[model samples]
Target chain A: MSVTAPKGFKASGVAAGLKTSGNLDVALLLNDGPDATAAGVFTANRVKAAPVLWSQQVLKGRAVRAVVLNAGGANACTGPAGFQDTHRTAEHVAAKLGGMGPGQVAVCSTGLIGERLPMANLLSGVDSAVRKLERTGGDDAALAIMTTDTRPKTTVVEGDGWTVGGMAKGAGMLAPAMATMLCVITTDASAGGDALHEALTQACRVTFDRLDSDGCMSTNDTVLLLASGASGVEPTQEELTEAVTKACHDLAQQLLDDAEGHTKKITIEVVGAADEQDAVEVARSIARNNLVKCALFGNDPNWGRILAAVGTTSAQFESDELNVAINGVWVCRGGAAAEDRSKVDLSGENISIVVDLNAGKQTATVWTNDLSHAYVHENSAYSS
Target chain B: MSVTAPKGFKASGVAAGLKTSGNLDVALLLNDGPDATAAGVFTANRVKAAPVLWSQQVLKGRAVRAVVLNAGGANACTGPAGFQDTHRTAEHVAAKLGGMGPGQVAVCSTGLIGERLPMANLLSGVDSAVRKLERTGGDDAALAIMTTDTRPKTTVVEGDGWTVGGMAKGAGMLAPAMATMLCVITTDASAGGDALHEALTQACRVTFDRLDSDGCMSTNDTVLLLASGASGVEPTQEELTEAVTKACHDLAQQLLDDAEGHTKKITIEVVGAADEQDAVEVARSIARNNLVKCALFGNDPNWGRILAAVGTTSAQFESDELNVAINGVWVCRGGAAAEDRSKVDLSGENISIVVDLNAGKQTATVWTNDLSHAYVHENSAYSS
Candidate 1:
C-alpha cells in the first residue's frame, strides 16, 4: 500500500494499451478529503515534457484533488499537440470526479520522447481507474509507472499522529530505459499549502537530489507531495518535514539499489572542506568520474584517479594534503600511497570511498554506481 | 621522421626494462642547435604528475637542451619522492648530453600513477639513448612512449621556408592506461620564447583542447614546442602560429583515431550560439554525455538524448527553437521531430552532429569518441 497507506486516499492502476507488453500503464491517485494541499518539484532541465508543463500550471493553485500518471509515451518534444494531450487528460480526470475542474489535477508521463500519447486509450483507462479506485490499489499503482524497473519501490514513515508514504519507479540505472524518475508522496498530516511546499522542498533536497546514477538528467523527472487533513492532528512543519524526508530517503535508496547494470552501490563522502557547497562539489566530481567508477567496478584501489577527479573541481583543497580511503582502508594518506592496496576487500555489494581535504570542518556524501560492460551494452543497444 | 624532421634535432629511443613486455620504454630528444628557445603547456589538472611539474619549471627558464620520456610509470601523487625522481631523471639527461644543467632538460612520464620510477634502469637507458641519438631516430623515439597506444603518431607541416614536426602518444581513449597525452614538437623557424608560447597556446586551444574522448582529463598532459632557429627565415608570429596549429590539429585528430575501443570519430558542432564560449560549452556537454555517446555507438539517431544534453548546459538557448541535424539530416527542428530519423546513417566511421541554437552568430566544434562495450571492458579490466 504505497500512496493509499495515508488516510482518506484511494488509487487504481489500469491497462491503457500504451505499453506493447500489455502491462498496467496508467495510474490514478485520488484524495477524498476535507482538505487537499499539494506541492511539487520538477527536473531542472530546460526541455521539460508536456505533463511537466501542465502540472506546473496546476501547482500554482496549491490544491490537487487527484494525480494521473502514465507510462510508454513521454509526450516530450511533441510541440503544441503534446500539451493539448496532457490538458485533455487532466480535463477528463476532473470530469470523472464531480465538482472538480482540470486545475485540481496533476499529470505525469514517462517513456520515449518525441511521441504522441494515445489519448483515446488513456482517457478510457482513466475512466476505468476511477471506477476501480480503492485503498488496496496503491500496489498496482506503484507497478503501473514502471518502464524498465525490475521491481516496484514503496516506502512509509509513521509519525506520532500523521503518516507519510510514497512510491517511485526508475530502472535506467543499468538498463537502456528512459529512466524518467516519477514519484508521488501522500500524507494525512494537517498542513497548509505553504507548509506542505516548504516541507517537500526540504525533504527532496537531501534525498532525491543527491543521487547521480548515470549523470543523465531527464526531461521528465517529477516528484509530487499531496496532503489531506483527515488525520485531524496538527503537527509542526518541522515534524512533517522529518517524516516526509525519511520516506523519500528510503525510496531513493530503493531506486539506487534497482539502478540498471549496477553491481556496487558506492557512496563517496568528502570531509574537511571549506564549506558545504565545496564539499558537495568535490564529492559530486568524484562520484561522476568514469575512471573512478571503472576502478570501483574492477575492485581496484586506484586512488590516483580519485585525486585526478578532485583536481578538476574548483573546490578548496591542497593536492598534497588530500587523503582517500577505500572500504575503510586508507590506501592514500597525505596524497601518497599508504596502506597496502591488496589488503582492501572489495568483494561486496556496497563500497565506501572517503576523501579528506584537511581544509576545514565541512562534509557531504553522494551516491553513485560503477560503470560496467553491462551498462554500456544496455545503454547502447537501442533507443529506450 | 617525426620530431627529428626539423633541421636541428636528434632523437633516440632505448629499452630500459621498465615495461614488463621488454619494449622500448625510454626516449630522448636533444636540441643540438646554436639556439634553443622553447615553450610548454601542462595539464590543467591541479594534481599534476611530477614530470609535468618539472617540465613547467623548465619552461620558465625559456630554453631547453633535451627532453627525457618514459612510459612505465607516472610519478604522480607520490609526494616529494616523486618530484625527486623527476629531478634526478632530468639531471641524468643533462649529464648524458654534456655541458648542460638539469634545469635545461625536461622530463615527461606516462603510465600508472602513484608509483616510483626505477632509477637504476632509467638512468642507464638515458646513457644509452644519448649515445645512440641520431637525426633519423625520431620514429624510434615516437614508438617508445607507448602504454596502450597501438601505433606512433607523427605529423609534419611545411611552411615557405620553415617546418614544424611533432610526435604524440595517447591511447587512454577507452582504456585506463593513464591516458597521459604527451607531444614533443620541434620547429626550425626563428621564434623567441614569448612568440613560441603565444603560438603554442593558440594552437592547442582550438585543437587538442577541443578533443574530449571519455571526458577524463589526465594528470600528465604535456605539449612542448622547441625552436632551434635552424631555418634562417624569420616568419611573422601569425605565419608560425598557422604552421604549428596545422601540426597540432593533425596530431590531435590522430590521437582521436587511435583512441581505445572507439569505432567512430564524432564531430559535434554547435552553431548560432550567443557567443563562442557558450558554443564550446554546449558542444562539450553534448560530447561528454554517456547516453549520447552510446547512441552513436549503436548507430542510432537518438535526437532526444542530444537535446537533453543541451538542456543541461548553462548556455543560452530557447528550448523550442533549438534544431539538431545528424549526418546532415535535420532529425529535430524547432525542438520537435522533423525529418525521418531513420534516414540518418551512422554506419560509417565518421559521424557529424550539428546543433543550431538560432540565438546568435557564434560557432564551436568538439571531437569525441562513442562509448562502446569494448571501452567499458578495457577500462574496467585493470588499473593501468
Candidate 2:
C-alpha cells in the first residue's frame, strides 16, 4: 500500500495493450476526498510530452481528484494530435469517475517518444481500472507505471493521525531537476493547495533534484501530491514538509538502487564551498564526468580525473587546495597524491566520494551511478 | 614530412625507460630558424599541468628555439615538485641547444597524471632525441607522442611559396575549448608573433575547438605555432589563416577517426540558430550526449534522443518548429515524426546529423565519436 496507505484513496492498474509484453500498463489513482487538493512538478525539458502539457494545465486548478498514467508511448513530439489524445485520456478518466470535470484529472505517459497512443485500447483499460479500484491496489498502480524499472518503488511516512505515501517508476534517462519518472504521492492530512505545493517543492529540491543517474533529462517527468482530509489532521507546514521529504527521499533512493544497469550507487558529498550553488555545481560536474565514472567502475582511485572534472566548473576553489577522499581515505590532498589509493576499497555496491573545496562553509550532495558495460549494452541495444 | 615539411625545422624521436613497452616516448623538434616567432594555446581547465604552466611562460616571450615533448608521464598534479621537473627539462633542452636560454624552450608531456617523471631516464631520452634530430624526423616525432593513439597524425598545406605542416597526438578525453591533445605546427612564412597568434587563434576556433569526443577536457592540452621565415614569403593573414585552418582540420579529423574505442565518427551540424555561439552550443550538446552516441553505435535511427538533446539548450527555437535529419533522411520535421526512421542507415563508420532550429541563419558543426562497449572496456581496464 503506497499511495493507498493514506485514507480516502483508491487505486488500480490494468493491461492496456500499450505494452507489447501485455503487462499492466495503465494506472488510475482516485481521491475519494472530503477535500480535493493537489500540487505537481514536471520536467524542465521544453519539448514536453502531451500528457505533461495537459497536466500542467490541470495543475493550474489545483483541485485534482484523479490521476491516470501509462507506460508505453510517451505521446511526445506528436504535434496537436498528441495533445488531443492526452485531453481525451483525462476526459475519459473524469467521465468514469462521475460528476468530475476533465480539469480535475491529471495525465502522464512514459516510454518511446514521437508516437501516438492506442486510444480505443487505452479508454477500455481506464474503464477496467476504475471498476477494479480498491484501497489496497497501490502496488498494482506502482507496477503499471514502470518502463525499464526492474521493481516497483513505494514508501510511506506516518504522521500524528494522517499518513503520506508515494510511488515512483524510473530506470533510465535520469538526471538533475528530476529523473525520467512518474511519481504520485497521496496524504489524508488537511492542507491547502499552496501549502502542499510548497511542501512538495521543498521536498523535491533536495531529494529528487540531486540525482543524476545518466545525465539525460526526459520529455515526460511528473510528480504529484494529493490531499483528501479524511484523517482531519491539520499538521503545520513544517511537519508536512518533513514527512513529505522523508517519503520523497525513500522513493528517490529506490530509484537510484534500481537505475538501469548500474553496478554501484555512488554518493558525492561536496563540502567547503563558497555557497550551496557552488558546491552543487562542483558535485554535478564530477557526477557527469564519464572518465571519472569509468575509473570508479574499475575500482581505481583516480583522483586526477576527479580533480580534472572539478577544474571544468566555475565554482570558487583553489586548485592546489582541493582535497578528495574515497571511502574515508584521502587519496588526493592539496591537489596532489597523499594516501595510497590501493587502500580505498571500491568492490562494494555503495561508494562514497568526498570533495572538499576548502573555500568556505557551504555544502551539497549529488548522487550518481557508474558507467558499466551493462549500462552501455542496455542503453545501446534497446530504444528506451 | 610533417612539421619538417616547412623549411628550417628538424625533429627526432627516442625510446626511453619511461614506457615499460620500450616504445619511442620522447620527441625533440628544433627550429633551425633565422627568425623564431611563435604563438601558443593551452587548455582552458584551471587545474593545469606543470608542462602547460612552463609552456605558457615560455610563450610569453613570443620566441622559441625548440620544443621537447614526452609521452608516458603527464607530470600533472605533482605539486611544486612537478613544476621543478618541467623547469629542469626545459633548462636541459636549452643547454643542449648551445646559445638558447630556458625561456626559449617549450615542454609538453602526456600520459598518466598525478605522478612524478623518471628524471634520469627522461633526461637521457632528451639527450638522445637532440643528437638524432634530422629534417625528415617529423614522422618519428609524431609516433613518439602516442599514448593510446593507434597511428601518427600529420598534415601539410602548401602556400604560394611557404608551407604549413603540423602533427598532433590524442586518443581520448577530447572536448571543447580544446581536445586533450598536443600539437605543434611549423611554417616557413614570414610573420610576426602578433600575426601568427591571430592566424592560429582564428584557425583553431573553427577546427580543433569543435571536436568533442568524450566530453572530458584535459589538464595538458597545448597547441603551438612556430614561424621560421625560411622561404622568405610573407603571405597575407587571410592566406596564412586558411592554410593553418586546413592543417588543423586535417589533424582534427585524424584524431576523431582514431578516438579510443570508437566505432563511428559523427558530425553534428546545427543550423538556423540565432548566432554562432548558439549553433556551437547546440552542436556540442548533441555531440556529447552519450545516449545519442550509443544509439548511433547500435545502428538505431533514434532521432528522438537527438531532439531531446537539442531541447536541453537555451538556443532560441520553438520546439514545434525544430527539424532533424540523420544521414540525409528527415526523420523529424516540425518537431514530429515526418519520414520513416527506417530510411536512415547507420551501418557506416561516418554519420551526419543535421538539426535545423528554424530560428535564424547562423550555423556550426561539431565532430564526435560513438560511445561503444570498447570505450567502457578500455577506459575501465586501464588507469589512463
Enumerate the candidates' DockQ scores in order.
0.68, 0.72
For model 2, give the TM-score of chain B. 0.99
Output DockQ, candidate 1: 0.68
Span of ten consecutive residues with least summed lDDT in model 2 chain A: A172-181
Q: What is the C-alpha lDDT of each candidate?
A: 0.87, 0.91
lDDT, candidate 1, B286-356, per-residue tens: 88788888888888888888988898888999888989999999999888899999899888999999999
Among these predictions, the greatest TM-score belongs to 2
Candidate 2, after superposition: displacement of residue B22 in Å?
Answer: 1.1
Candidate 1's C-alpha runs over 4 A off are: A173-180, B173-180
Clashes of each: 3, 0
